[model samples]
Target: MARIKDVAAQAGVSVATVSRVLNDNPSVTEETRNRVHDAMAALNYRPNAVARSLRTEATRTLGLIIGDILNPFFSELARAVEDEAREAGYTVIMGNADERPDQQDHYVRTLMEQRVDGLLICPTAEVTPLVEEVSLGERPLVFLDRTLSGVEVPSVRADGSTAIAELVAHLRGLGHRRIAFVSGPSTLSTGRERTEAFLRAAAEHGLEVPEEYVRVGDFRAGSGRRITAELLDLAEPPQAIFLGDNLMTLGALDEVRERGLDIPGDVALASFDDVPWFNHINPRITAISQPTAELGRRAVRLILDALHGRPTDSVVLPATLVVRESCGETGPGKEDGS
Candidate 1:
């Protein structure tokens, strides 16, 4: 109900003086600033953020578009991003794509229309032309967790090669030769890289993975369940199964339970992303844990650097393997050893 004019009239100062005080301009005397503050408090006046942003041409807000909010990995990443942004005096708007390219594009366009100072995205499998358009435009953009090929945007992602190799080696030590892989869709970089890494590692251990052993899923629980079922139906089923992500791992676990299969006894299990629930689950899951919070912090820093016209570079953090009961490692062993 109160406006700047009301504050100015109450403070007995010019509207320009009120504006300078609100903007924290040092030219205004302390006495005048206190008067303006008192008037504002008395009238319960709130400044219009839209008007301020329009004048400065900076919204002081960032947009984040995640592939799937349902995935615990993305949800944790979002929380970290929000925390880092808030600490840096910026606000964040998040969009959940639910692993759909169309929905991802819609959020991107919507955030752009809202004049977000920068954007961070964990892109979906299908690449939308709008992503390229945004990257080429004036707005600073960064990719998180996942990225698109041929796009030059700066990004922060985990390098899972070493961890995947470690996992395969661990399985080999456990005497699992016929390893099956439930891979995510190959449309995104993480999917392709992870699958490629797993196969390469399996070969290094002198193990052969049949083409039938590799099942591709859409990074959802349903796909995980279906793929696991298919793998179980094979005449010569795999001795162990590696899931691409946490959501799919849940599905695989469900199918294994439905068939009354005992983990590490009937079929060994492992997953890529390590979430909080992984530890409390019946068979503590073995996982390659990415530096998720660090990734979020680094992503914000990259976008802020670009926003301030500073040099920026892409970052690739390494993942570490956490051995647990699910991978048949229950004894006292080194956390980082195979």
Candidate 2:
């Protein structure tokens, strides 16, 4: 098998210069880099990834732990993260927590055992003790989408307050008086922030959401369906329902369809996290459109910065309300300039 020595001899350069070219060190002149590449190709010299990692003490891999892979939003986020990681010359190993703390911790420990250079996580409901331990360790860590309080880890997320308010205003304008909410687990920062923002917005519009109208969900389709069914079965069912995320929105839509109810006529529907499928469905769903790709890219950047001993800061991108037929917003000027 061809080796680095063979490549160096063929290229008429020292092994160190070949190594620099292999490592993509910008210090190597373009001519030297081209010559080294030609030599490597001619000699069929393939660098051993394991040997390189052992020497550099870096695996060039990242661990991404998502809360739920079943959700389209999360799936899209994972794809974006992988794309960004790949662009930065890193590979990503992903773990799905399924919104469970134990599962999240298990993935964290397993990824650590695999010696991933850094970790990007969408935390589950409760802050696991394992997370704290990992944060204190030398390995770089960053939160994506969902964040833990007091963890001191940088994060990239969307600020949904304005979008929530816009949604509330849109619903109110559609003559919706009694509105219900299907909220995600309050233990997560995203769940808590979105839920609180909805309540605040509703209150500002002089609308009060009674206890019966507020249902807590697990950010899953089943919880959304169950909660939506409960809300619909109430003696005074709400005229509209706001879902916390896309998965629950699917659940709500399923339940609404099963009951032979027409959207925007029986119960108007809107949700956070706009997915591509939302547009293709009958009565296109209104949603809070987040910068999903940007969020993923920023999260990876933050982890890279941490790994390189550079300071990292949390990033909060803005979300905008996308008006559609589901929310009874067919009039002109209904959609935000998202």
Candidate 3:
């Protein structure tokens, strides 16, 4: 396919010149406009609808709906999507759901109003019906990270069960029998799957996980801190904790430090999702590192494939467990570190 750069090169003008001529902005010289038009004809450059939509309807743009743009994970994913979309000559419209169903629904409706060519969505926990409705719409849509039940759309996600099991096994190897599993709300598939995997992993190790030891909170630093404090005050505090998400991990770490308790020495910690700051912090946190970049790239590809009428299926990428100093008193063995 001939790109804008090709048209610009052929016209011996800058990309901006080509854009101006294509939009008929009345700001370009007649000679320059003719050169661009000749180049477009020679290269068979198809003007995007948005460039001509100043007086018409279609907007050659894509909408990206993320659960929480504040989180590094979602931000990175959004960045990747934006980069890919721009390279394909499409602009991206981003909307933050704040993990709220109503906000998500509003964003979807707003994006539709903007006449986006397609959508990439990370659905909120409570908006399954909304997701299904969008998927059934004329615009092509692809789900990212977590998927909605009964929604037959291409999706990209990490292997939550395997990642959780690996994290739990690593904790068990460090001699942590009584482990606390702190998680986000079980309403979402990611949270629910991770929590269930924690329980199943505990059973595999013949460890009894008491109900009090398992606490669910919002996927936030404050929730992590609050829940970690509650776990520590239990009659028999857990020797180790498997935290659900990155924000929750931050909260738990803050709580542990505030209490003057040493990491791995007093209460071991492990979490899902390895964010950028994980390594720089004191007593680096051990984490299950999902292929975030791969997930983002694959999600974009899936959407593009659907747009091109290329059939694709839901994809679950593998996760890597990065063993750091946060596991137990003895620390991770050489073979386990990644």
Q: Which stretches in model 2 have alpha-carbon errors above 4 Å?
A: 1-56, 335-338
For model 3, which pairs clash? Answer: none
User: What stretches of model 1 exceed 4 Å from their correct place?
Assistant: 1-56, 335-338
Tens-place lDDT per residue, model 3, 154-270, is 789988787788778878888888999988788888889888888998898898999999999888899999999999998899999888899899899999999999888999988
The ten-residue window of minimal lDDT in model 2 covers 48-57
Residues 1-338 of candidate 1: C-alpha lDDT, one tens digit per residue: 78777889999997667766766778999999999999999999886443233223689899999988888888889999999999999999999998888998888878877878988999887655567546655567899998888778899999999999999998998888999999998888999999999999998999999999998998899999999999999999999999999999999999999999999899999999998888887788898899999999999999999989999999999999898988776545644333
| Winning candidate number (lDDT) | 1
TM-score of each model, in listed order:
0.82, 0.81, 0.80
Per-model RMSD to reference: 13.3, 13.6, 13.7
Quantify all predictions' global Cα lDDT against the true fold.
Answer: 0.87, 0.86, 0.81
Clashes of 1: 0
Candidate 3, which segments miss by more than 4 Å at Cα?
A: 1-58, 128-130, 329-338
Clashes of each: 0, 0, 0
Error of 1 at 127 (Å): 2.8
Per-residue lDDT of candidate 2, residues 258-330 (tens digit): 9999998999999999988888888889988999989999999999998899989899999998998997857
